[model samples]
Target: MAEFFDNYGALLAQGTIDTLVMTIASCIFAYVIGLPLGIWFAVTAPGGLKPNTAVNTVLGWIINIGRSIPFIILLVAIIPFTRLVVGTSLGVPGAVVPLTVAAAPFVARIVEQSLAEVDKDLIEAAHSFGSSNAQIVVKVLLKESLPSLVRGAAITFVNLFGYSAMAGTVGAGGLGDIAIRYGYQRFQGDVMLAAVILCVVLVQVFQSLGDWLARSIDKR
Candidate 1:
């Protein structure tokens, strides 16, 4: 173990940083796209305040299609697009594009579910105050759904963490790549074990933070 640490510890540490970078950057970008898209889906669906079937239907299909595509397939399928955007499809930068694309729809679904859980009474109360659609969505729905949203964010982050590792399979730098190249390919079980432990640790830390924040902020 000491020898392993001496030789590969630094590499694993760098891989962890790269993985966090890819995971976090992808999450920010995914949420930027997903949040509004989710709101649109929620407010345009049947019985939604704005109830527009055409808009809802189209958005649903698009989101569903995006969610249906497997992440590994997505990682490969968008190689050209990823390269076009990042000018390469290997390493952390290359991984970000695909991770972002892969996560957006999943994030959207999470957001949709979070919003769906908000009590209708709260929305009705907002409407009673003559709140505009935007006001209700922003103030009531999002605010009330804060805990659930935070939890959803945790789930999304964890899910994306896995995707980032898979991205490592194609030379996307991270613990995944290290584990793949050294642990699996090179038959370095210690390296693989270390990489897996690091990933689990990262996920647990993130999830605990998210859950704590959600609980702290929750009023109800």
Candidate 2:
């Protein structure tokens, strides 16, 4: 046990950190792009505040196209774009671009769904008070949807975690990389098992925290 720990412990620790960095960075960037897009989607739907069918249809098709691409394929296909954005496509930074790209559309959909669930009565009440679209969005739609948004964030994080691992297969450098290198290439079952176990634990932690946070803030 000591020999095993001494041989691979630091590698695992660094891999975990890299995975986290990729996941967290990807999550932040994905939300940055997705949140406003989602608000636009909800606000411009047929029965929405603005009701521009053309804008919604175009955006919907774009998002659908983005979401339709599998991450691995997207990862390879976007190598040039990723390299242009981050200067390389081989590490934590490199992995983030594709992860963000892959996740943003999904995040947008989640946000749209959450905001769509906001009580129409609340929006009507806001409108009665002469609230502008921006005010209603910030003060009413977003406020009411905070819990669901948090939950969605957690889901996004978990997904990015998996994506980060997959990125490792291509030299993105994380637990996935470690698992592939030591566990698979070197035929070390123990190393692979440890990496898998750590991944499971991290996922559980993220999911539980998300659920707890959503529950704590949910008024309904």
Best by lDDT: 2
How many collisions between residues are there in candidate 2? 0
Candidate maximizing TM-score: 2
lDDT of 1: 0.90
Clashes of each: 0, 0
Give RMSD to native, each candidate.
Answer: 1.1, 1.0
* Runs off by more than 4 Å, candidate 2: none
- Residue-by-residue lDDT tens digits, candidate 1, 14-99: 99999999999999999999999999899897888799999999999999999999989989999999999989988888889989
Q: Can you give the lDDT of residue 192 in candidate 2?
A: 91
What would the TM-score be for candidate 1 when compared with the true structure? 0.96
Which ranges of candidate 1 are over 4 A from the true structure? none
